[model samples]
Target: MFTKILVALDRSPMGKQVFEQALALAKATGASLMLLHVLSAEEEGSPYAPLLTNFDYYPGVGSQSFEHYQKQWDNFKNEGIQLLQSLSAQANTAGVNAEFTQQLGSPGRLICQLATTWGADLIIMGRRGRSGLKELFLGSVSNYVLHHAPCSVHVISVPSQVTQAEEAPQETASVN
Candidate 1:
């Protein structure tokens, strides 16, 4: 019954899974799909950014200025745009009406904002399956959206292997 379905994806392997779910839902409901990818400011400006990239730092290299960080952020957004373009192409080839967007900000907040602004009837996203204390400490994006989203949220969780691993201890304890 959804007219507008918004799917939030990342470059992670789980992105394909999330897109598949979104495409199926759109196909079944004849809904238009909006694919979104958000790059967190914290991630772009993190101290470990250099380590994450191929950039090598010399011991006496100049410190990173504001302009440097700004340029890096721009590059990150460009990469995200490219990824979204590829995904959008796939969706289009599948005969699904799909448009994609790339935004920079907190993933949870941006997702909710876009969902509300775009009047999305449903939001499909992938979660890494973090739970318990780890979730509490790390802050689950899906959890945030579930509580705050304006519409129904469908979370395509991580693969069963990860979920099962996370639940192993609980499953063992329950049997005792």
Candidate 2:
């Protein structure tokens, strides 16, 4: 029933899965799909902020919070743009009308905002993301989107890597 769909993705397998799923849905509905990725200031860097708060997590956590995350944030933005491009190509090959947007900000907040700005009818995303336990404590982007999405939101739970690993043994046994 959806005509406009938005999918958020990063450089993770789960993100890939989410995009694939969205593309399939778009194809079935003859809908348009948007691939959006947002880079957090903390994940990228706030070089333009009036005042810089040092970031010292990964390498420079001891600095202030801004210095350390700037480079990382930049990398995240650039990498995410590349990924969105690749996803757009795949969607095109699938004969699905797809466009992409790479923005900067908090992932959850930005995702929800795009849904409104793009007038998306539906949002499809992974329930658990790459953030791991930190996401659990901070609440996941999916969680936030689920609660705040304008129209409708579908939070699909992707099977974890650990489960895929464990399933290998079962897969081979089942094959024989």
Best candidate per TM-score, number?
1
Q: Please, what is the whole-model Cα lDDT of each candidate in the order they appear?
A: 0.81, 0.76
Separate clash counts for every candidate: 0, 14
lDDT of 1: 0.81
Per-residue CA lDDT of model 2 for 52-154, tens digit only, reads: 4433334634554565556765766677788898889989999988999988678889998999999999998876543556665666777778888898887
Off by over 4 Å in 1: 41-72, 163-176
RMSD of each: 6.3, 6.7
**Considering only N, C-alpha and C atoms within 3 Å, which residue pairs clash in candidate 1?**
none
State the lDDT of candidate 1 residue by residue for 38-111, as single tens digits. Answer: 88633323322444343345443344654576676677778788988888888788888899898766889999
